[model samples]
Target: MSDEPMDAATPAGAEAAGLAPADRPIFFIHTPKTGGNTVISHFLAFLPVEQVFPPPPQLTLLDGDFATARERLPGLRFLHGHVRVTLTGLLPLERLRLVTFVRHPVRLVASHYLYFRHMPELPMHQAAKALGIADFLRRYPSYGTNPQTRYLTLALGLRRPGVHQEVSEQALAALEHFDFVGVTERMQDSLTALSEHYALPNFPPARLNEGKASRDEVEATEAVLRRDEFLMRLGADFLLRREAEERLEKWFATRRAAQARGALLQGLKGAAAMPWVAARAGDAALSFLEGWHPQGWVGEPRDGAQYWWTEDRARIVLASASGRGLRIGMHVVETLGFDPARIRVILGNRLLKTETAPAEPGAEVSFRIDAATFARHRRTAVIELAGPRSATFAELDPATADHRLRSFAVRRFTIEPLED
Candidate 1:
């Protein structure tokens, strides 16, 4: 498939994929101010104007006449709006694919503040302008935390009484169902990932509903945020964003590797098999960094590629189908605040391999256990990693003084099995 997004004006993308554009419903769960406006413009290009839901006004979530709109519009397939997740016209959930984009919580909150300050047409926006950000948050605390969680999980249903933790887990669980999820920070990367699933057009967003805040203003608001509280709020959203980033990175990497080897279809097939890579909550293997012991690893995903941070030792257990002589492999890089050190890998007294960390940041170390050694623990193994020096986030940066001890994060860990 072409890396370029589909021309929104034409049905080329759908046609190329052998899908009937008229009947294939693509639901846009438009979260507020996350570069969705630009996507809407592209969606308009190919889809007939009537096929889109009730004309998205400045406030698009207006509830009324959906049944009427479905009856009126013939060949409705693309619906983009502020409404909750839903569809109609004999289209089942499988036929309809859901899509949405996410932004950083702090940035999103800051942008929302400025947006309300500038646009006072809406009663809530006018009221929000009168109240400062802190005051505004006191009333609507969801903005700072997992606002995306609420939108994705609770849409169409009234909220049952539950704490943020419960809500967050549910939201994260639900996020796996989305066909394509994008991140605002990496717009082009997100589009690239989206293209892998659907034919997206090259049309860049007009950058609609974007608000600019000076660094000082953003910093001041950030300072007011309680670190723990802010983290709790951004928890579900952060996970979702990290998953999106990893997917995009892996897509680009796979495409590059495939192009070099003249096996592009094989790369596409890998991504297709695991479209909801990080989103799956089960024990099944999916992505490179997944299937690690949850308790030992550092909290929160670090950088575009997530890894299990380890110093002296880290244990990760993976389940595999009955197979013989599976080759064990893993990818690792030096931590931000640590010196390059050799990583010692062991599986039940069997020294699979010891790999030296890369000299530079972008460079990585990939080492695999010999087939004979890997076969010993082909079903499951308590893999271990050891290094000389490790540092905490607080020690690394005084400005962000987080006290958790950290070490090298793994970008990929693989157990390649032979099909017999």
Candidate 2:
């Protein structure tokens, strides 16, 4: 029998090599040491040459902000860089389809150490010279300190604080805004899912470091993995097991909502009344506009009375004397996380420590503002509720109402004079 082309229609055979023509170019944020090379290599094989751009020389920093770059290079898709997701604001909220991979922190750190050892410019040896295994372990928090470290820690849920601090709370908040998170331990499975999502051909195998180390060396390094309590805590804290994945999924959703809100505020350029008005008209506008408006407005009636503003910029105070206190409640929610330096609290001429009045569960406590502090700060105060117990009035229901208490005071004030 003559050799014939294998049946192309067969269901069991390997699929054709290369992605479909209709597939859009994917923007890959190639976080370092997380199988980024493998992803790039596989993607390059199928993607058009123009679609793939080498990461910037910095490796850690992409060429420009994703949004601005995307605008300049339209039809630009598929970004592979050792950059943070927040830095790449290219993907709009609706269009974003984020995918990232994370490895075990120990493995990641080891790989990073070995990679840096070969770079003549990097002072890896000098840094490690005085540092023994124990010293290295103690300084492990430093590993996850910068953008690179933060990117990996948040993506993988690895919380080991190296000599470098792990990911900052803010960075973690940003990473949680993703749609899909692929664990590096399960590279094949993750790649398969990624291929289907992006409609690509086969995924190439990962490139392992060729440098050889003695069994003793390997054992020594692996030993660090076991003794490090922070690494262990990180693993437990992330809850990487199947059950924990569900919890992470829920957390990601909440963070995504928060990120979307933050993005909206950051995008606003001026005191454009129309945009604010439109935002206010929308459903749940009070919550969205909370801590947002310079000049506050009264919201709908609840309980018995309408929510209204009692003071102006010179001496501002929002109060809900009656009704459900929903307006004041919404105000508190917006002000809770603001930085203190951005706002000042004063009563008449004397500045008062911005303080929150504690309220019993399910009971409404009237909020009192010091006029002196308001005046000293020029009627601008960024209210923040600190501590584990203080619950925003909006979060107060019959169930969690007992947890509500005053925690922090806003001290700093950023005064933006009303434009002429």
Candidate 3:
């Protein structure tokens, strides 16, 4: 809320806890659909060819023992790939710096759905096309529930059907040791943070694998109304994602501040003048704040690319791309965890518009914030959305195990500068 980065006093992991740093070979898990390919490619470009395990094109992981990979690619210090979370037993954890990235449960599933439907090489494409959203969600738990948890914990890799506390704890414990656990949404920031922390090269990464120009992902998803059904299974995943986000936010924020300080100090020595350094830092901070606009009421968007849960009092900040006034627009979707209720929308706590819609699956609810609100801020504005009540899975379906607070879903939220 306060634009200030997280407090540096609290420790994020073992490194912060003052444990001896284990400068072991790096082991990165390229979880599917989390933009790991871009990361992998960048690492391949920067890392010494012989130091890259199995090399590019054959990226993500190796086929055999660590010893075999070591023999094949001598001097290799980093092992990465589309790997499993249960590598604790397979590798020397004490001697390896582990890292991975995760996306929001909903986005991750959607990306997989879109990506899988296009690739004919994958045998499941036809079946996925036929399964649609609901059937695909029901038939494959991954589309619905704690899918990433399976890859995070080892027990699930045993082909088991249920979640285990011990296994979850073990997996979390393993994560505690990772030098970095990045979120896909904040990838640029995450990479910069990683580079600063590890002294690795930092550069812009290319966006990877958009997918075949076949059926539209959104159309296919909407064709079968599974938003509510899909979220029902995301209870565990949402919790997991929240935890990961809180931790990463602190990690990235802290590193970002540190980098700013380091840059300023370096600038004082002729990297640039003090005023130039200050301007650069201010510009960076402004860009970061602009990115948080149109977020879910409760917190920032999960991946900065999609959806925010509603809050009794939510604020949407806006900054015009051209420093001109904006014609703000917002479209809200019925979350359908419970019956919908009337919601009040406010612009900068000055102007107000309201709407009420039933809490049915795929419910369309929307309102606009008057462009006149922008008159107060020249080129920036903060819009607020408030709901009479929060929704929960238990309230929607008595059998649902989730009790966490939630609100409506948002299909689209945006603001465009008013043209002359």
Question: Highest lDDT among the candidates is held by which one?
Answer: 1
Tens digit of lDDT per residue, candidate 3, span 319-365?
43234443333445554445344555565445464444543224445
Would you list the C-alpha lDDT of every candidate in the order shown? 0.56, 0.41, 0.55
As for lDDT, the candidate ahead, 1 or 3, is 1
The total of clashing pairs for model 2 equals: 36
Pairwise lDDT winner, candidates 1 and 2? 1
Kindly indicate the candidate among 2 and 3 with the higher TM-score.
Answer: 3
- Candidate 1 deviation (Cα RMSD): 13.0
* Model 1 TM-score on a 0 to 1 scale: 0.55
Ranking by lDDT: 1, 3, 2
In model 1, which range of ten residues has the least summed lDDT? Answer: 275-284
Q: What digit string (tens of lDDT, one per residue) describes model 2 on residues 117-217?
A: 44557666555445654465466555522434455444333453443333345334434544455656666666666675556687466453243445566
Reference-based TM-score of each model: 0.55, 0.42, 0.54
Mind giving the per-residue lDDT tens digits that candidate 1 earns over 1-420? 679855222244345666565466777778887888777776665556767765554436455655554465446667667764433222233445567787776666777776776776855687666776777777877666677666766642324224355464555555565666788888767765665567656555545554556667667766665456566667766777777677666566555433322221222235333322321112223232222323332356565446566544555443333323344445565455544445566566666654454533333554453434435544334455555566666686888876666656665655455444
